[model samples]
Target: MLEDLAFPIERLGQAVTDVQLLFEKYKYENGIIFGHAKDGNLHFVISQGFFTKEDIDRFEHFNQDLFDLVLNKYDGALKAEHSTGRAVSAFVEKEWGPAAYRVMKRLKNVIDPANLLNPGIIITEDKQAHVHDLKVMPVVEEEVDKCIECGYCEQSCPSRDLTLTPRRRIVIRRAIKRMEDTGDRAGRKALLKDYRYDGMETGAVDGMCGELPGEH
Candidate 1:
């Protein structure tokens, strides 16, 4: 759970009949599902690669299909959590119905006419908002590959004040990996030399990352 928060997460929560309700259709390969199973609310992480229009369009389609399955078909909530953000804001009206959404828009206009606070937050008026400004994940190692680079993990890190942060560690590792892949031995060696202290040594809060699921 902490690991998911530590990384850049692109996906949203889906509360289903069960997690298997999700598996019954699509094979969520690059993601993992875990949450309060006993209470029927489950959270999963799926790394999205939104590099192109077709890519964003694919995700947009998935989001709509998911909304249809959850909200239209199964009669589930679009957001198990409170705030929807842009990812699910497009569906807010669909979830709450037209009249309720109007009330929400009216309330927002009344309170924040100029829209000073959080421009594209909860209730977005954009028709194709979800298709725009999508976050794309780069090709990294499988260990940190699934990370969306969201930096949620920095807050609870024990070594945050000691040296580098969890996010910083991953970022440096990415550079070092890039150098290695590009055959720049000198650059890679230099990065590893500094990383040996800042990211490698000082970043480990008594082997917190080693506690990942299924790790020995």
Candidate 2:
């Protein structure tokens, strides 16, 4: 099934090419490199020294270049698993071309013209919209206020049963909460969706996954 849908061998080759390009461009000093080549998705985390403003600009350039090479070159979508949010949505046009992007823009306008639903994400007229200004909900904030950061959740999570860590989920909750406090509704929404939820269930703890009423 995976080989038939979006995770074919060709896609995997493109992902490998993309990662190699990034490594060569950045001279890959120190960073964690991991991802699923079978799915054509990869992630890298460099040291703080590589995160300066100039480096960010360079990174954005690299991102675009890599996107062009991988998506266009391989005829693959820019985003397969992840939703194109504020961070990567700006490149959608480049990946999908003007015609498809226009259709998406029109759909967004019809469904959420007020931009109140989730602004500056997936679609935005303003190219300068910062990552801080696109939050859509506040689930994370509510959760952090409840957690004492005692690390119990980490110790309890069964992800370690598979040699995995659950720390990222906790961090994501806190980060989205901070974004929510800043009044960035679109940003919050983007973060919320990252956790694979439409919205929080009533009376449910922020990070805990619960079925939305009527969803089941």
Candidate 3:
């Protein structure tokens, strides 16, 4: 899980240290920490797995601890680079205070009465909604599993306009792997049938995606 934490500009060093310590407490020793220090925005990516009930409980506790540390202790923001999506929706009220949060709720109700505009995303009543509907990253192959799904490879790929770009190709492969794991043979076969044309024929096998600076 990658979260951009925001704190007072002067407290960047302390905030980073606290976050690193927190990661260690949660047994996430290999957590990747980086970001815009000038703006006091620290982006930390921790490898989290929600495969079992124990994993989910651990994540919930870790997230609650993280929120408490950032919001209560440091007076920081959980979402600095992105909107308060489902990941941090339940904390919007705690972060903004009751009055401001009520105003935001009223504004949302007035603007979107039917609750159609990304309902349960920015402001949700379900406290555990963030943990629900979690994406399961299937281990397809060593190279494919390592992809972060960043679209940097799409721009330089020769097959960008022809068919599926490099990113989409990885996405389809991942989907296929999931289908196979779940015994969805029909779906896997169908996707593989199309992949031969869109992913192979139209794909540029010239190592163009690799020539870029980063991994493909």
Which candidate leads the pack in TM-score? 3
Supply candidate 2's per-residue lDDT for 107.
94
**TM-score on alpha carbons, each prediction:** 0.62, 0.53, 0.86
**On a 0 to 100 scale, what is the lDDT of residue 54 in model 3?**
88
Across residues 91-154, which tens digit of lDDT does each residue of candidate 3 receive? 8888999999899999999999999999899778887887998878887666776777757887
lDDT tens digits, residues 1-216, model 1? 111111112222333333345444444455577655444455666655566776666666666666676666556665664446777777789888999999998999999999998887777878677777754344555776655566887887778887777777777666766666678789877766776677656656644233222112
Task: Write down the worst ten-residue block by lDDT for model 1.
Answer: 1-10
Off by over 4 Å in 2: 1-8, 31-33, 36-51, 128-216
Q: Which 10 consecutive positions of candidate 3 have the poorest summed lDDT? A: 207-216
**130-165, model 2: which lDDT tens digit per residue?**
233432323443443444343665666655444223
Shift in Å, residue 154, candidate 3: 4.6
Instruction: Tell me how far the alpha carbon of residue 5 in candidate 2 is from the true structure, in angstroms, after superposition.
Output: 14
Q: Considering every candidate listed, which one attains the maximal lDDT?
A: 3
Candidate 2, which ten residues in sequence have the lowest lDDT sum?
1-10
Please identify which of the two predictions, 1 or 2, would achieve the higher TM-score against the true structure: 1
